[model samples]
Target: MQLNFFPLNFQFTDYQITDVNYSDELLLDLRRRYNTSHSFFRFGENIYLSNSDSDSGIDIATNTTSKNVYGDNQITASLIKHIFFRTFKKRFISYTPVDFYPFRFFSSKEKDDLLFDLLPNQLKGRIGYKKMIEVQLRLATIAGKQQFGFVINIARNWIFEKNCATLNLEGYNLLNVEVLHSEIYPGSCGILAPNEEFIGIISEIINDETAKVLTNEGEQVFPLTELFIRKTKFNIANYLDFALSPDKTSQILNHIESKKQEIYNTKSLHTEICEIAKALFSSKLDGHSIEFMNKDGFYFTVQDKPLEVTNTFDLKTPTFIFDPAGTKTNNNNPDLGLSNFGPYDSISFDIKSPSVLCICHRENRGYFSKFLADLKDGIPSSRYFIKGFQKKYELTEVNFQINELSAFTLAEYIRVMKEWDQEFRPDLAIIEIPNEFRKLKDADNPYYQLKGKLLSYEIPVQYVLTERIKTYNEYILNSICLQLYAKLGGTPWVLPANRSVDREIIIGIGHSWIRKNQFKGADQSKIVGITTFLSSDGQYLLGDKVKDVAFENYFEELLNSLKSSFNRLESEQGWQEGDTVRLIFHIFKPVKNTEFDVISRFVKDITKYRIKFAFVTISKSHPHLLFDPNQPGVNGKGAYIPNRATNVFLDSETCIVQMLGVKDLKTAKQAMSTPIQIKIRTPQGNYNNPELNDMLYYDLAYIVQQIFSFTYLSWRSFLPAELPATMLYSNLISKLLSKMRNVNGWDADRLNYSLKRKKWFL
Candidate 1:
């Protein structure tokens, strides 16, 4: 291989090989004659040495005599040495003397480029060109290796302005040794090197010798072509080279393009959805007036009253009014709403288009503010196309009677909204609702106390509740409308989407602390500890699954795109065996999705074929009946209970013992002490059907693949399915589901419907 070497910074000083050595005796004699202390030698006013003996000036003799070795013709090697010595002495004397004290090199600030600032008055000027070159050499060599990544190259016209320096780095590659050398000098040349040869030598050595060694066979490795060089106040650092593969680079470009498209798509969708929503909720009114529908009314204060009714001479200007008669408005903000349509104003003249706006409520705690700050810092400014502005208003919370809310109170709320419209005339309004509404309405729940108080006002208002309701999508949309109506007085334009409630619940299970240590044998190892935590249980449960599935499909598409982009051919048709993935299944209690029930039954229906299976139950307060069954007694009935003589202890092996239907610390301890052959302890405890085990696994694989799209992603940190657990689980599930789908006598949808109709969820 042809290796190219480039020493990054070798130009400042030249390296020379020498055979001559000065004798210690000679130096000692010279010191004494000069009357200089042996520790401090001085040749003249400015020339001095740290190791010299005398302070007096001293000079070495240039006289030389020949020495015969073979006695053939006299060879004058001594003469040649004398000539070199004499010449060096003359050159040294001719140049101005400058003392380079040891402090210049040994000083604490020697590494600092600003060391000159810390110099002693007398020693400052003594430190001149020679000392500077020495410092520069040392710094360059040290920084070269440390700062070898993140290279920057400047265009010819690039100019950098810094304190005490202005660098016009024309056509400068930060990695170039010459450029670095130039940066060390004073004045214009400080940014450009005087010794090009020295720089060239450094470049050669860095490119081949040092960098090559580091790259091919060293503890550190770096990319050669992409060698990085960075500059700072102190010094320049260099990194060896690395280059991105063409395919990877192309993939990144594609990803960027996809991101741009996604942003565009989201904005477009928001606009369309907003338009549709606004059209549905708008109502027409007389000139310069508009009406909107609302379930919960929001409160606002008008700072100024509009002009009284008067016939104006100029008929062209549009007139806006808040309330013809003085009226009171509502206090608390509500979100319940519905779609309505209305004319912009009663006048025949067309109203100007309302500006669509989006508002997010101010979080009481600073958590959201901090999150936004982090987002602002982390996300590139270019990524956020919209400029987000926010403002907050403080108002007293008021409660109106239910009758007041429906009629006069409602009118007052509308009036306040109109007043707000006169000022900002906002097209849309956004509001936040309490997230804990379930407890309030149930049995004098403390949570709903506020809602009840507001309802007593009897106002026809818009409101959004913070409840985990089933199919709550419609509620969310209406709440958005309500906020708009409450704020705009005259409806501007706005839309909202419904929220989904079928609230999901997740359960986590673990063994109790006391039982964990005492029950399991001390000598027995705890290698596999099973703990189950609920992923999600609600109407929108597994909603993330859709995204995952899309990502999976996207990955496949990406691969295909890669092949086409690079024009590569696939060797096989259809999906190869290795391409298929296995899935793990987890179901939270109180599943509301009818489709999932159908899937559960399908697992049972295909149980004729023997299949391995596992199951667990999770609960915090009560032991599960299905999994934590009572252990057998001496009479084959039940074991002795801790509190009641007639009651038996529950079996720990049962899935029911697990909290949240997943293995946790508590259940793990129980399993350790329990007998291994206790078949009843296994998860599928309810059904000893071996065929169903395989079918269950098969179905799980299908579900995960269908949900996530790709089989490549792996699941980590599970109790079982060792080595490649999630993959294996997914594979098995897929196989089972495929078989069920093809079963001879079953209808796919019918099977699904059965699971929903029959609550087989335990």
Candidate 2:
């Protein structure tokens, strides 16, 4: 196994800077004077010149300062990054700083040639396109050794240009746009000026020439000519629908490969960096130079040769209990397991006479009737709802013509259903929606309106796309039935747990941002936090506590909800005094010290039981890639993909796990899969006290193995999910809650009452 990292060797660890009183204004002036000269750069509050020569007016100090370049020091990292930015300005046409290292690179091609030439004629002038390449120089400490490397990928950004205002001369109603500001400095790189911009969402079209724009500062009036519309993935997708032909797609891919080879290949990338390093060192920067550890004229390389210091955990295939007697079981596959032995709690499944209501266009009545019949009676060679689960359902039909599936029509239908038969509430609804509905705004979308109304009546729905009905097969039916069973409050299966003396609870924290208006992007978006609780066996306990609040208040609300849930669990589970309780939090991204501070304070307050906790972050966006030379490839071709479940320990508290492998790829054309990086936060501040540290001592191997097992517990599908059920469930809840908030009169609290224990989000 080979990593992308290379080691660096510095000739000297010391440098000198001018001793001057630090202020924002002085730092700005110094940057303007020397930034373009490739002589000085700003790091935090000080300006450090590259050389000790007295060319500038400022006096130089004789004293030398040192930075820990090998360790996790921010000053050293920032200095190296700044040097790279200044050097690369003369190479790339334009650059946008994403972080200290990662940058988006633009070419020097003509602006007219950069547009997406394959777009339809009608959309050609309305959308702007740019071909960008993302590159990052990563530095990290891996396996007790410091390393550095580069990762590169292609980025195709579809922008809405200022010409959109001219295209729609009548005036724009609701639009999301970005306004360019020339005065702002574009980070450390001085390649371009207009890249410094801010977002504005147009709410009301005042006239053909002006509009009311809402920004972070406040609502203001701006001329249409000054605003450039902002296009998101969702917005661009509405027009192209990702409908590129095979030839066009192949052409684009070939162009990407050619560009990558020109700059991002290992040989070319190393040469470019080495050239810059040579120039900088030759200039005698502060009378010192930094060099990389060279081996055969190449940077030092690291490989997973012995496979030492790495731990691999193989999780056992979970078994399903299909009968009350616990006599029948299967562990290989969920679909075959359930088909052979039925559901785990089939005997106690109370919805024996389930009912389904169908809604579709009147013209498609025959198509839906056949579709529902197959679902109820089981398609050929497919185990379905009735025979497989031993439950029959009554069917109800409702039809509407084209352009009739409106909010008014849905409300009237619900009213008529309630009036005709007081006891005619259906257990589930199967609605066939057109694809065009996806293009509408949330406030005007019939899909959201229908779902919100159905959920209010305590009815779960299964929406079937009209385009997919023709291509539905046994595999699709199998997956759909599994979800329907779970949504109807039935347990299909659970992961076999290794019983322990201590009780453990896993909590997953996920969030989504909600803009004030879906069409008009807002500067400040509210956050919706979703918290999910599960037992050690991966059985979801209840619906998440979804709260919508400002960003500043999210953590406080999360802490309160967690405390209340823990208190309830302590009493309900009959936990005794001095009993050990372990809480492991699996969050989506790395959080701040404040999160730990709040959690640590909460644990200190509990005296009845001894509590231990670990905060683990599982991220997939890091610039790390793992390649194995020994692994076999498809069709006897070379493939560097590692096997699933392969874990490499980066350090004591961090590891990378490959959840998908060659077999997981549906097609050979799929891009290489990247593994998720799992990191356990180290306790800091007061939490690092000797007594508390002892309580927080967690086995990193066990925590990772448990997470892998939980990935098999997502009831939505038979195949294992990329992420564990904890994070998956929380994310699903957050997204749904965020969208439903736009529905008029929709109450999130109602979920706690009616669908609290059911997997309705599945």
- Residue pairs clashing in model 2 are 51-286
TM values, all candidates = 0.17, 0.76
For each candidate, how many residue pairs have backbone atoms clashing (under 3 Å)? 142, 1
Q: lDDT by residue for model 2 over 189-222, one digit each (tens)?
A: 4454344345566666777777776766677787
lDDT of 1 by residue, 1-762 (tens): 000011121111211111112555654554455322222222222222221222332354332223232231112112122222222223333322111211011111232222233334543432311111110100011111310000111011111122111111222223323221222223213212222111111122233213221211222322232232322211211111112244543443344344433322212222332332222122223222112111111111111111111111111111111122212111111110111112111122122232321111233223323323322222224322111111011111111111111221223333434444344432322212345534343333322222222222221123333231222332232333223222222222111111231211221111111111221122222111111211111111111101112322432332232223111111222223223212123332212232133333433432322222232222222211111123322222222111110111122221111111122222221221111111121232324455444433322222222222111111111111111222233233333223332333322223221122111110
lDDT of 2 at 489: 79
Q: Which stretches of candidate 1 lie over 4 Å from their true place?
A: 1-430, 433-583, 588-600, 604-613, 623-688, 694-762
What TM-score does prediction 1 earn? 0.17
